[model samples]
Target: MRLNAAPRLPWMLGLAGLIPFVATAAATWLAPIAWQVVAIRAFLGYAAVILSFLGGVQWGVAMCRERPGETPFRARMLLAMVPSLLAWPALLLHPLTGAWVLVAGFVLVRFHECSRDGRTQLPDWYQSLRTLLTLVVLACHGLVIWRLAGA
Candidate 1:
């Protein structure tokens, strides 16, 4: 395929990356309630889902005028996020592991593309900040999951 033809790279990559994350996320929910990992997973899962939606919108707007030949980054990004929405409700049974898997893949696509284009590279501290936020979000979700599982 032509270099440009692979423009859907971000969506594909994000989906691939999200698989393991989804698996891990599911485990958090599956873990014996005493493990208390479910809350954290739920929160991360939620944030990841929401952020991906917003990110997709941004990506779509950025490529708004690109010709039909050009890949609609935003559109595909938005499409990639669809799974996340579906996954949220699936949390009922591990919520949306499949959806989160897609989210991870989409994110990977963005991360790789950004690095490849030499455009925007998140700073080390920023990455750290994300990690911290992710942890906190995951913790919160775990609490929610715990409560749900108990009911």
Candidate 2:
């Protein structure tokens, strides 16, 4: 993969990634009703799984649009599922999987977007903010999982 020297990395992709995280977190934390938490987490969990797959399709779009010097990043993008896919099943079976499936899936989608254009086509601000936001989302998911487990 040729290095992208210019501002790349699809920074907006990172921000796009933040949507689910922020939305999920708000639904969980700011809501007055308790069922809202369950509704948000359950729906988001499933949606995250489906969306990651969709994001992969979008990833294909980027790969197809590959510039002359770019390396095929689709393979790397696909591999991000290792954690999420595994966690997803563990979540269903054990319920103690920390529901990391959703978190992993979310990150995979974000990483898929952020890593686009060989990491050079994106803006730096977007990447860092995305990374930060993603981590926060992951942390929130972990907390949610723990809460559900204890209940």
Candidate 3:
């Protein structure tokens, strides 16, 4: 699916959302030593929020696609909640550990969405956009992890 087919508003908003992740990741390296921890924390927090937001997206999709009592509906709803569950606890862990957790959450959510049944329910352009965004988000997480390790 071509990203050009996606609505302009959603596509632009999604790309704009990357600013926080990019800025925080860059700040980890560019900020003074005393402020690096602050940058890391902000990065972690933003990651958690985005992760949770992904879950909410899933939940919205499930609600729209599935009937209340269907077997797949229950499963989809349960799966939709997983990202938030992973993200909330991650906030309390060390920044390095939290980043790792967020990375895993993003990967798992994207993986699920790429499943055969998952693809059938969502628009092709959305999946394409998600793939692009997830790759960039993971790269930002990698940068933060590398910075943390070297500190």
Candidate 3 per-residue lDDT, tens place, 72-133, comes to 78878899899999999999998788889999999999989899766757877898788878
TM-scores for all candidates: the values are 0.34, 0.49, 0.95
Which residue runs of candidate 1 sit more than 4 Å off their true CA positions? 1-54, 57-120
What is residue 23's positional error in candidate 1, in angstroms? 27
* Count: clashes, candidate 3: 0
Instruction: Write out the backbone clash pairs for model 3.
Output: none
Error of 1 at 93 (Å): 7.3
- In terms of TM-score, which candidate is strongest? 3
lDDT of 1 by residue, 30-125 (tens): 667655355445445555565565455445544553344445543454544554554455444454453344345445544543453312332333
Steric clash count of candidate 2: 6
Error of 1 at 46 (Å): 6.9
